[model samples]
Target: MEKGTFQDVNAQVVQRCREGDNRAQYELYKLYSKAMFNVSMRITNDYAESEDVLQEAFISAFKNLHSYKAEASFGSWLKRIVINASVNAVRKRRSELVPLEDRIAGDIPDEEYDDDTEWQVEQVRRAIQRLPDGYRVVLSLYLLEGFDHAEIGEVLGISESTSKSQYSRARKKLLEIMKDTHSMA
Candidate 1:
């Protein structure tokens, strides 16, 4: 099916779900659960917790379906809920106390890496998994999830500047991890 046709069918399913159709709800879940689960996992970094978050997010989305205007795609709306649930799960697990000084740092140069080095997807994913929670969340939201720094700041409850700084630091750290792994290989 063409991308547009697929989206149209999804929109119909979403409408049916809003009207409380169980089968349509299940169809929506089938279409989106894997991607949403990945989003939850990246944020929470625990398979069990990701599963919990994913379930809660879907429930929340279904309950609040009436409020979902088509301003964004259904997947985008669902992703926002998953991200919120995952972040809340992380907060419940541990307090993320980034120092004020760290958040206030002046504009750091965006690190440039050597274009000659080839990196594997598995290596990159593992490196991302190893990042600190603050860096990982910002990086994942901005790079993988297609959120701008401003949107990330809104979702994460940080200033836009802080979001940018965290993303910059995450990129540098990811590169370092990749290089180290490459050398050891």
Candidate 2:
């Protein structure tokens, strides 16, 4: 579907939701739940925790639907909520969001290139899950979720430079994990 078409349908559903339509709310939830759950899972890295975060994010999004204002697509708006809730869940479990500030930004690696295109999606996913919380969150936000460094910084409450360096490190770690697994297999 075209982006504009979905946005049009979403606007109408959002309007109905703003009027307290339960079915419309359910429609929106059904439309977004799976993707949002993945968002939560990528950050929290725990199935049960991701489920809980998904439910909490939906409830919060519904309650705050009035504030949505259609400035962005409903999915984008809901995604921001899911990401924030997921980050919070991680923070609550870990006690803080230390941005792995040990290394200076100068240590951040440049993007690496690989000609091999044989990696399985599951392999990459497992590798991401193995990352430390700080690295995983930054990597997920910057890579999987399409948040730029500045946006990731805002969402993760770290400096933009920190987000960049953390992502570089995460990418490096992910490649190491994948390489080790391939060698073992």
* Most TM-score-accurate candidate: 2
Candidate 1 deviant stretches above 4 angstroms:
96-119
What TM-score, over all chains together, does every model reach? 0.82, 0.83
Cα lDDT of model 1 by residue, 119-174, tens digit: 35555776787777778889989988999999999998999999999999999998
How does residue 25 of candidate 1 score in lDDT?
94
Tell me the alpha-carbon RMSD of every candidate. Answer: 8.0, 7.9
* Sliding window of 10 residues with minimal summed lDDT for model 1: 100-109
> What lDDT would candidate 2 get against the real structure?
0.85
Model 1 TM-score, 2 decimals: 0.82
Q: So what's the TM-score on candidate 2?
A: 0.83
